[model samples]
Target: MPADQELDQELDQELDQELDQELDQELDQDPTGGYRPLVVVLLSPLAFALVFASWTIFAVLGVELKALLGFGEAHFAVLLAMPMAIGGLAALPMAALAQRIGGRRVMIACLLLICPFLWGLSHASDYHHLLLAGAGLGLGAGSLAAGLVYVSGLCPRRHAGLALGLYGAGMVGAGLSYLLLPLISQAYGWRTAPLLYLLPVLLVAALLWLFAEDREAEPDVPDPLQESPPRSPPAALLRRLACWRLWRLALVYSFFYGTFVALALWLPAYLSAQYRLPLREAALAALPFTLAVGVGQVVGGALADARDFRALRWWVSAFVLVCLFLLSYPPFVMQVQGVHGVIALHYDAPLWGFLLLLSLMGAAMGVGKGSLMRLIHRDHRDEMALVGGLALTLGGLFAALLPLVFAVGNEWVGIRTAGFMFLYASLIACMLVMVWDHASDRGARA
Candidate 1:
């Protein structure tokens, strides 16, 4: 009996030691040799930026296409939004596949898939061809889901927010497109613009294939409570969707990220139509807004790493509310009765004012984008891929829907500011829900 008891104790100690070794390996820095993870962290964004640039190219060139195709505002809106709609549908599945097959593989596949589409876009002759190319272009947007999962695994949790933020700064690709597409189209025609993208996409895919390590290839470290009875990807996704907090975050993201995407696609057209600016001039004017978003994301990520996410959320929400309110105000002429004659007041925002307000709005949304992901990490670290994918999917879903709404609103109301009005209403709803959520949390604690 004494010998049996001693043998049991020895087996338990061996099990504990094995578990400890596995945990240490999981936490080890530079698991793939010297600075390989760092290389990935740096290079992944370049790949993502390239993909994002391709994904949003239609935004810059769609104006020419609209005229060429003889499409209405509604048709133009759908063309602008097609990539996002397809992307939203693809995000979850791609993210889940990244988890299983490895993000590196998934990301490479995304880039490869996008190449043919981009080539197709370059040669497209009709609206149907554009639609097909636009749908395929969505693979670039969906690539983000895989890229995020890949980057998240590369860095430690302490710096994950900043790393992800820097990676997300790839969103600057939109700005790059806004700046470059016009120049390219002017010089070489709109069709030639897509051909330029093929080189970068192919190069980045090669780099990733050669350098990036797959986290899935690492040995699994099992924690009974954390790892036991592993759930299927679909089951995990459904479970995450079941969380009320995920739904709330999805709504908030829809307002911020979705609005950002919609505006990015819509702004040049808006400026040309409303202010009677030439297309090139309008594209140039939209540049500051896109640049601000890129800078804001980096700043927001740093802030999230250093500060409380709840405080960051409050400040970001307030800023967006104020900016959206100001933006929603349409050109107005006010009249008041006077002793002499009727005093007349006409107030219209100049181009600079519009740029300034939109820049600030972009900054606020950028911060919100960075900080919100940190909150998800805090609450759902184990399920980051599922939750993050869903949040992005919802954001893309709104990006798709809001443009259609903007088109319909403008048509029905004959006000170009109708889009901003819709955005303002959405922000108000988000604020109310945020308040309710805070109150509920306090009640639960009490």
Candidate 2:
């Protein structure tokens, strides 16, 4: 291994070069506009981040609730998943409404919508009460689409990927639960922990109302004569929904984003169980993966903006495959006959190495999230609200379902690393689809 001085020198040189390049570039500007686009991208994401925090709060809160209420594992898992499930259900309706009323209005309403749920959560005395609060809180998931439409609307078409990435980075706010929940739950009480969210939610709603610009609610109405008059409204919608390519893109997004969220809730417990780390320590340990994902979104989006991303997708997926292959190995002792004697072998990932691999996997997924979103917008800018809504909906449902899958894998497979193996297999299936898609494209070209 290199000495400390050599590593430090190399790190310092890299940092200096990055800083120098940033300095040489002029001040940051919004796409095709002045500071307004920047304000939209930044402020809306800030609002989204606050709302996003609630989506994962139940995971933190459910541990205590499950015991207090004396529930089984399945019920507890359902409680943890309620927000995402309901939110996914709500996204399409909310997106349709946003397309009518404007994303700014929908965003403000979604932010305000979380306030009452926080109050209810603080007051919840029964499992049903908590479930109701959680379901209501799930409505805030619709804000992902609102934030997407809001941020991308202000920027020019070319910059849509970076804007979406910035908005998606708001997911980092889900980490807030890991930071503040345990402390507040300890200092006050679990009941009072939800109260801490009330003030900020209200404040963000008001700020969005006063400051954010409103895009025209909908695209210009098409002349009736331009369409086939015999087609019914439902038929028109069915045709729109029949796009297989759109479905594929949405499914791809669902896996990346869904996996990010699933791991966010799962890793804390996984780390605690596998390595026998303390619960709080495991939560803290997970911060690197979340942080890398947040930062990587921007880096990936910017790269997509600058060049072709078709090949990048393959390379990144391959990298994740390698990481997951390493992660999927369960701790075991193996024996084999050697030339001289029987040999014994033991294998288990050290905590640091596992965390390092998680960070790498998270980064690659974030890049994929960014670049693929850019591709979606590049092709479907006119229908962004609808397409983005479909993506968010699928992602939320995917996140909601994965915990059960993980639990099933653990129980039936009788392996601690079963979750990773499941992810590895699922990702391989997704990659195979990508390969098929690429081959088809090449054949079509020929």
Steric overlap count per candidate:
0, 0
The Cα RMSD of model 1 versus the native structure comes to 7.6
Q: What C-alpha lDDT, on a 0 to 100 scale, does residue 265 get in candidate 1?
A: 84
Against the reference, the lDDT scores of all candidates come to: 0.80, 0.77
Residue range 1-446, candidate 1, lDDT tens digits: 24654575456446545654664476564356446667678777887788778866877887898888888888888888899999888988888788778888898899999999999998898888988998998877667899888877666566667888888888778777877888999999998999988988899899889987886554667776885688886686677678797776656866777888888888888998889988888888898887888788877777776654656777888888888888878899999999999999998999999899999889888888888776666556566678778888888888998878879878988888888888888888888998999789668756
Instruction: Write down the RMSD of candidate 2 (Cα, Å).
Output: 8.6
Candidate 2 at residue 385, lDDT?
A: 74
TM-score of 1: 0.90
Please list the residue runs of candidate 2 whose C-alpha ends up more than 4 Å from where it truly belongs after superposition.
1-35, 218-227, 230-233, 339-341
